[model samples]
Target: MRSRPVLVYDGDCAFCSSCVAFVERRIRPRCDTTPWQFADLAALGVVQQRAAYEVLWVTPDGRVRGGAQAVARLLLNAGGVWAVPGALLTLPPLRWIAHGLYRLVADHRDRMPGGTPACALPAARPPGPPGGS
Candidate 1:
């Protein structure tokens, strides 16, 4: 049997906590779900920079999948009805669209319900001259 993966999320983000709660009450995947603040990220081989950017799904094999891909992995792991949509989101065109949408939501999470300014993405680099020179 495949070992349960760990779902790492931002403990400081209210929006993230709300979503995590929803997953707990509804989806209930056979995995360990936790806030990044409490997890030993270094031991898990999860870089803080990446964790700051997106939710991470650390598989038993220690492979990390983040953002939309992580969500898909979680859904699939939930099995039953979730498996279909999860599988679909990972396929071809849908995968591309899903990723883009995930970034959009993640970048604007601060404006979402239960979210705060702290949930916003780090300030983006200002545009500069061609080739940054």
Candidate 2:
């Protein structure tokens, strides 16, 4: 297993890329930040469908956190001054609100700064018969 955690995000979304860049530059997290498009999801035990929905934080011990939780984990891992805010954000009321806000931003990311129409998620596949079509 690797020594550092992995921050997995969407490569097709420009807004996501910008956010990743900001974290890399400002937070300087002690982890490897990678786009899902280039990540070996199977090795990470991450599903493609879930990854399409939100950013993921995969711990070295094989733990996985998504969305707001993932963001908090990343910030916490950065250590020092950032740890306080990260800890606060993961608490009660703020945690609930943070999750909601994370969902809102993720759902409408195509309209956010640095995002384009192409940033929208692809249509999900419809369920089929148990065995095969």
Candidate 3:
């Protein structure tokens, strides 16, 4: 088990790095932040493909949240005025919107400010039916 929660991001993506830096400087969530490439993913209960696809929030007890959910967790952990929006993000309707927006941004991160060609993610695979391959 980890002593602290960890926020895992892609180090090679300049846009992702910049976003993490902003969170550290502005949001100041009470957690350790690390690039997935440098983190012990197995210990964090994160898989490589998921880490490659989205930012992750790993709890001390080993629960892992990814993508927009990770962002919501970060905000909720920060507490204070930020908590409202964070909590809202976890709710329905808004949750769906947040997920959609997150996917949009992630899919085009290479075009985002501070992004480099390295920020371009690999094409994502379509989801299979539940309990089926």
Candidate 4:
């Protein structure tokens, strides 16, 4: 597999930028190489008209991961202290716990740096039944 991994982030996010920087500095040191691909959701097919999004990482195999799972997957690839925690977090009971923690962060990201309350929430569906027009 190619060593260089790709991380997709919100181009307009300051917190996301900081996280990218941390990945470039701290995370990169542990892994092979992370070639970050900053993308506007509109261009990446994650249209803002659909859902409020977070970070995504593309693995060498082209599998995509989002939120804390992405972070853990990246760390696991790095294969160090970062990997240890991620690996540990993936264990049976811990996996459930880890996903819970991830959900908390995803749910309240609006309060975090670079997160906008307006955009943090997913798009609401128009009121209607399951049937199409």
Using TM-score as the measure, which candidate wins?
Answer: 3
Which parts of model 2 are misplaced by more than 4 Å? 123-133
Instruction: Mark the 10 consecutive residues where model 2 has the least summed lDDT.
Output: 123-132
The pairs that clash in candidate 3 are: none
lDDT of 4 by residue, 74-130 (tens): 778777677898787767787778777766766666678767754354632332334
> In model 3, which regions exceed 4 Å deviation?
126-132
lDDT of 2: 0.89
Worst lDDT run of 10 residues, candidate 3, spans 123-132
- Model 1 RMSD, rounded to 1 decimal: 4.3
Which candidate ranks first by lDDT, i.e. highest? 3
Task: Give the number of colliding residue pairs in candidate 2.
Answer: 0
Taken over the whole model, the C-alpha lDDT of each candidate is 0.85, 0.89, 0.91, 0.58
Candidate 1 lDDT, 36-84, residue by residue in tens: 8898898777877678778999998899888889999999999999989
> Candidate 4 — which residues are off by over 4 angstroms?
1-3, 29-52, 114-119, 124-133
**Candidate 3 per-residue C-alpha lDDT over 1-133 given as tens digits, one digit per residue, 9 for 90 to 100:** 5687899999999999999999999999999999999989888888777888899999999898888999999999999998899999999999999999999999899999998999998865433345648
Give the higher-TM-score candidate: 1 or 4.
Answer: 1
Which TM-score value belongs to model 2? 0.90
Per-residue C-alpha lDDT of model 2 across residues 13-125, encoded as one tens digit per residue: 99999999999999999999999999999889888877888899999988999999999999899999989878988999999999989988888889999999877877433
